[model samples]
Structure formats: C-alpha cells, structure tokens
Target: MRSMEVDMIRTLETDKAPKPLSAYAQGIEIPPGHRVVHVSGQVGVTLDGQIPADPARQHELAWENALAVLAAAGMDHTHIVDAHCYITERSHLGIYRATRDRFLKGHRPAATLLIVAGLADERLVVEVDLVAAAGAAGPAT
Candidate 1:
C-alpha cells in the first residue's frame, strides 16, 4: 500500500478540559504498536555553534533543530506527541508560539511552555525538547 500523511497519533481536545490559551491540545494518546522517541534538549545554537542574540531567531532555530532530530529518528513534526519548550523571557511567548506553530504545520500536539530565568549558556534564549512516536519504529541504534 502506498503511504501518505496520516494522523498516526491522537490529539486529545475536549470541551471538558480547560480551554487552552493557544493552539496546543490538552493531551495526546499514543496507540499500541507505535514506538516512542525522547529527544534531548535542542537549543538555539547553530551548527557552527553560534547562538543568535535575537530571541525570535533563537526560538525559530531551536524548533528547527528539534525537527532535524525528529527527521533523523525517521519521524517528522506530525509524529510528535508532546513538546516541552523553555524560553528565557516571558515576553517571547508570542515569538515561541509563532515559531512552534510554523514548524508543527497544522498538527496540534500536547505542549508545555516554561519561562525560565536562564539556561546553561546565557546566550541561549530558547530550548525545545520533543517526544515523537511512529509506526513500527525501531531504529534503536
């Protein structure tokens, strides 16, 4: 059978649950037979190890790095079941949401965002970590 884009994971959105402030869902359900991947914290640091001074740029790049790790695990943003993000500044919430929504396309996964005082590197403005699941996923190398 030819493969196409499918909602492999289930997003939990319900009126019974508290209304979300943004596009994130209340939760997500990963079905049996699917495998999960836990991605480490991906910061805004570039491949060349340069962290941009601009918070928006940092937020955007952090998501980009997360997407890269997902792809490496043979998954895409659609496979993401949860996203845990941290931003240094509370004012960067708008920028973080914009960047995250862009990377996630139209898929709404479970998410949690935290505003922190700082990170391991003071130059870093944002960090994104993800939990993704896919079908018959076994690349446990």
Candidate 2:
C-alpha cells in the first residue's frame, strides 16, 4: 500500500487594507482536501466563570474563548475562514470591532456582526463563533 501526504494550508496578506493587529493573518486559504471545523458561539465568561461588566472586556473575552475552542480542534487563528459576532448593544460596536481587529490581527476572514437583544446570559455583552479548516492527511470521507 502507498501512503499519501496532505498539502499545507496557506495564508494571504495584502497591502490593500489596513494592517492587521498581529493576532491573525489578512486571509487564509484551505486547499481542496481539507477538513472544516466549526466552533460554537462563545460568551464572555472566563475559565474562572467570571463575566466582565464592561462591554469591551466582554468582547475580548469572547474572542479569546472562541480561539481556545479552535485550538482544541487542532487549528489556530490562521485556519479561521469565517466568524460571526453578536453584540448586545449598538454602542458596543466600536469596542467590539477594536477587540476583534486585535484578536484577528491581519486575518481578513469572512465575518458577520449582529446586534442582538441579549445572549444566553444577561451579563454577557458579546458572543463569537468561528469556522476553521485544515489539511487532512486521510482521504476525503
């Protein structure tokens, strides 16, 4: 029997737009034979079970939580292809964008932002979910 090797993933960064903060790349490219990973919406609650009162802090925590989930799936920020962000208040958009830009750095993945009435927890001001893809060594199932 013969073995097969999977190609590595690639990232795309361009000078066309503002530079990313440093946490992520401007874009990511997943080859044809890759596996996709989906991370559920993550709230602002910390590992210690504490949710910050400030919206900005909440936004940061949410992104951190989402990143952690992606890491658990054997992927990183560079593998992210899309993200969805939810904010409880319109006033928090600026803070949310700043936090997101910082966390994502230069990774310009497909994204969506929505202002919702509330989250599963009333104290949570922000929630974020992500999708990532990585090369798979095995044949497509």
Predicted structure with the largest lDDT when compared to the true one: 1
* Pairs of residues clashing in candidate 2: 20-105, 24-107, 25-106, 25-107, 26-106, 26-108
Model 1 TM-score relative to the real fold? 0.89
Off by over 4 Å in 1: 1-8, 137-141
Top-scoring candidate (TM-score): 1
lDDT of each: 0.84, 0.77
Residue range 1-141, candidate 1, lDDT tens digits: 122234466666677668779887788878788888899999998899998988888988899899898888888887888899998888888899889989999887889999999999989989999999887754442
Q: What TM-scores do the predictions have? A: 0.89, 0.75
Off by over 4 Å in 2: 1-31, 137-141
lDDT of 2 at 129: 93
RMSD value for candidate 2: 7.3
